[model samples]
Target chain A: MDKYLNSQIAKIDTSGIRKVFDLASKIKDPVNLSIGEPDFGFIPDVAKSLHEAIDSKCYKYTNTWGLSELRVAVAAKLKMTKKSDVLPEEVLITAGASGALDLLFRVITEPRDEIIIFDPYFMFYHELPRMLGANVIVLPTTKEFWPDIEALKKNINKKTKAVIINSPNNPTGAVYPERIIKDIIDVLDPYDTLLVSDEVYEDFIYDVGHVSPLCFYENTILVSSFSKNLALTGQRVGYAAGSRGVLMAMAKLQQYTYVCAPHLAQVAALQNLNLDISNYVSEYKERRDLIYDMLKDTFEIQKPEGAFYIYPKVGDGEKVALKSIEKDLIVVPGQVFSKSNEYLRISYAAPKDVLIKGANILKEVADELR
Target chain B: MDKYLNSQIAKIDTSGIRKVFDLASKIKDPVNLSIGEPDFGFIPDVAKSLHEAIDSKCYKYTNTWGLSELRVAVAAKLKMTKKSDVLPEEVLITAGASGALDLLFRVITEPRDEIIIFDPYFMFYHELPRMLGANVIVLPTTKEFWPDIEALKKNINKKTKAVIINSPNNPTGAVYPERIIKDIIDVLDPYDTLLVSDEVYEDFIYDVGHVSPLCFYENTILVSSFSKNLALTGQRVGYAAGSRGVLMAMAKLQQYTYVCAPHLAQVAALQNLNLDISNYVSEYKERRDLIYDMLKDTFEIQKPEGAFYIYPKVGDGEKVALKSIEKDLIVVPGQVFSKSNEYLRISYAAPKDVLIKGANILKEVADELR
Candidate 1:
């Protein structure tokens, strides 16, 4: 039976960072900072709308493409941000951002197709393409965690099918400036390479705000989800917007896979189509500032502009994370996101008091380890 | 971009059956019997549990394998009929049966791995395998739609990685009896082949009841969903139970794909852990009896044993269905399900009055055409 199984799945096992989380979950009270989701719940009004939808029999299957209203809502949101008239056909409602990535990779990449992935990338981007028989070519970043556009230019060959760019990146938490994004697009402009822009944390930016790659690249597929922004991770609702040709392929592939996201969740999402995140942004900024105030001098860390993560330089993330665990403070090692373990990712998406207490504990551990 | 697309996806267009459905929806007041979904909604207690779950703030990501309670409930249900000590580790909650199939096929099939699917099949069975670089060998059935197990034996070889067995089948409401199921298993037992038993319509049987392949086969993955029995198609929740080795591979692959099923839907399904399907079964029986009674004399048709569909041989199903459309009575052409257009699939899963009207119109068209 084991021999009959897909070998690629066996190739992907528990990451080192996952083991840290596993050890941390065993503790009764760990000041957890490895949370991927935001501390904020759905807007109060939105949750009520979900209840109303459930009572109104929103449980029946919508169209396989998804509820027409939600698709329209996704298009509207894109128009406001991406500054493009996105038609409903260009949008495919997915299980989440993860779901969008999965379907897009399946439809676009052929076997031995080279995909350019940045180092210090989101962990999911690693094995997915390789499993689909695509060859992964890692593009390492400089110390600043910005895209080395020259390195990208050197690697973009005819075999290169797609290049993934995750801004307000998971581990690094570095929101790319407009100039840097334009440089990356300029390097990709010559090639017909597909740009997969994952902006799941679009609403979570504290400074300078978010920008759409759709503004620069015609070949870009903007993948985003309501998981972090709307606190709907568990509901598994997301969407992908791109060129009509590419999206048509993704929608066709989705029919054979996830079918569609949950009907009731789609209906509820329609009620809160516009993101109202003033309070949420303010609260997270306070937490981010509090964390930086304590550990900023201890480690070579930058003040993050977006997402609920801060990746700081540490000698050995596994060792630091292990020491932090001993003090009941759960922090993830950077090896989860990249091949290197030189940095550790700390998530400060928690309450004010908890962050204050956790920061003190984290400072003590960092000082002791250093 | 079309040239750069995965050629398999381009080959598998939106289904012809789907086109028929699209056209049928425009008719203002057709006596519809072309539905694949059950007429009943979710169990009364389950919908309440879902609302309770939402109020309790259960809308966060569950473990990728799924909620422990739902897994336990699934294993418990299997223990009753399957007579095996099924464990939660062997069960993986999926997006739906379609999702389970997608995951399983991706993992098992290498390029050109041959899969066996019986003809007059559920339309979903056709394109998926072919898209995965697997050759779909359609096992042609007898005139009565019983599986040609002898024909299946001739085809099973080293390259045959899997074979799909669906009963109380779709389109044709022929329930495979225990003896027939046993014969199918006997052919499969020789090879290290996987048996994917789609018992989604298990609760819809009208005469000879459903049997589990898990009762006979060791290498079987029993794929069933709440879509039909519980009427939660829109929710898209289902489970796959099988050998731990295969399921572990599926669970791992799911992490990069769908992530997990919706959290609220999982909680809702827990309330109706045990099947209370007698009422649903009885009502479907009445509908089945009425349709069979009316059309038995009018056409060449078998007295269907299970499921909502009744396939009767007409001169040309396309002509009969088109003529029925003129009368505002909707019945699907059997060519949608099979290569030949000799039969039209009549769904009896409608209300009493609707089925009566649809059945009478069916008789009128059949008599005049004959």
Candidate 2:
């Protein structure tokens, strides 16, 4: 039955995150730090606005790009933070940051074009380009998950179509510092490369706030979601801000793909774009610090500057991860996100007590391994 | 700036349907017959169910393949119509039927793979496979818009990866009879091509009821949306039922694309699966008959068998369509759907009074052209 299917899709493995997602659902009483969903509910006002939007039934398919107001809202939010002015014409709202990547890559990539992805990035980034038959060049970040500028310089060339950088990154939780980001941009100085930034975790920063690639690069697409801040991960709604030419192409691809992102979500987003979420950021930071304290002495763990995850190096990660699961603590092994199994990505998006219980299991496994 | 982007995406003309959609919003008191949107709103029970789902805060992301119960619901719906039993595993709910097609062809198409598309079909189908650099073989149907068995058989070959057939079709509004469908199936007897049926208008058929490709072919992928039937065009939820292998692959692709259809839409669908829309279909039929009566004597017109559109032979369709708009009427030129300028598609999906006003204006324009 599958004989006539696209061979590349067969070669691309299903995401390991989904594997853990399904496994966590089936297992009983596991402290799940596997999935990256926020451990919070929707903000009060945002929830109210969404219900009102639904009641109105005004939430039909928006313009192929998005509702005019929502696109303007996205631009307004970006313009307030970025160094350069952002425009509605330069934005395309999407199903999620995931959907943005799907449309972006599909519009930009010809088969065999090279997309250089930083190693240990989001799992979908690993698969989405490959599904398009594009060659993915995985560049490993140095210690502390920093983008290695020299390595990036060596890789950038006439063939490099795009570079995917995730700040406040998934699993690793390493927020790319603005200085190094500028350095990486310098590396792409001689060639034309689209800088694609996944900034979905922008609201969860513990130290330096999120720096969009828009601040440094003209040819950049900044994609982020309300999934983390608004606690609507299950609601797949996000947006991409980039050059008008690229965004227009993405919007065209979107018409043939998802049609438009959920209209209700887009409306709610417009209503709550300014609602405060600093408390959520602070809470995530406290959890990040707590986990760092617990694992810092026993295991080599990077203290996350932002986002809700901490990547801890552990020998034989698969064995340790499986062993940790036996203790009713769910942690996704790093090998799932990379070519090697030297570390495990532990999400601190869980609540405090759950975080403590999961951290204790990690310490227990680390002590035994040491 | 687009030098590195896929050339095919540049070639994708954004749907002219959207142009009409936007224009309708602005034109003051134009008897609009341009868009194919269902004139009816969702029934009270379905609306209530949707609101209840939203208020309950259960509208989170469903399983990537979709909520299991929703898949089961879709399967059961298919079972009632098909000769053979269908299973939930063969069903993958999507953002819309648009999302279903996007994922399906992406997984099945290699570059330059020949996908047979019946001419005068949905605008998206023309652009989708071509976006992947897949060769689109356009087969013009007979004058009555039936799938010509000889033309179809001549196009069948080893390179043919799929055949896209839309029944109760858009624009042309031709619903294939079961005998012609069987003959088309016979043409595929020698090849390994997947039969893809877009049945989004299944419920709106006037004369002969909808015949799913599933009944005759095991390799068929049947995709339909709740948009037309439920009047939830903006809600972005639909399903694809096919062989387990293809459905599974589609689900994997969806995990990175739209992720899942809106959870609220799926929940509402579960509550209202038995809710009838036959009255809505009957209304469309009446409107269809009304428009046909007005134009039948003035021009060469094929009475629509099903669906809410009439393709009338009007000389210089673009010129007539433009002049019709000046008379405070809206009509889409046939050239938007095909090369020919002789026929313009008139949607009777408008209200009775609106259809009357629009049809009179159409007659005025056509009388001069004739």
> What TM-score would chain B receive for each of the candidates shown?
0.95, 0.95
- Model 1 segments more than 4 A misplaced: A11-13, B13-15, B367-369
Residue pairs with backbone overlap in model 2: A60-B234, A61-B234, A234-B61
TM-score of every candidate relative to the true structure: 0.96, 0.96
Full-model lDDT for every candidate: 0.83, 0.81
lDDT of 1 by residue, A130-181 (tens): 8887888888886768778889989998898988988888877788888878
TM-score of chain B of 2: 0.95
**Tens digits of lDDT, candidate 2, B206-304:** 887778779788878899888778877777888898878888888877877787887778887788876878788888888888888988898888778
Worst 10 residues of 2 chain B by lDDT: B15-24
Give model 1's docking category.
medium
Write down the TM-score of model 1's second chain.
0.95
Q: How does residue A188 of candidate 1 score in lDDT? A: 80
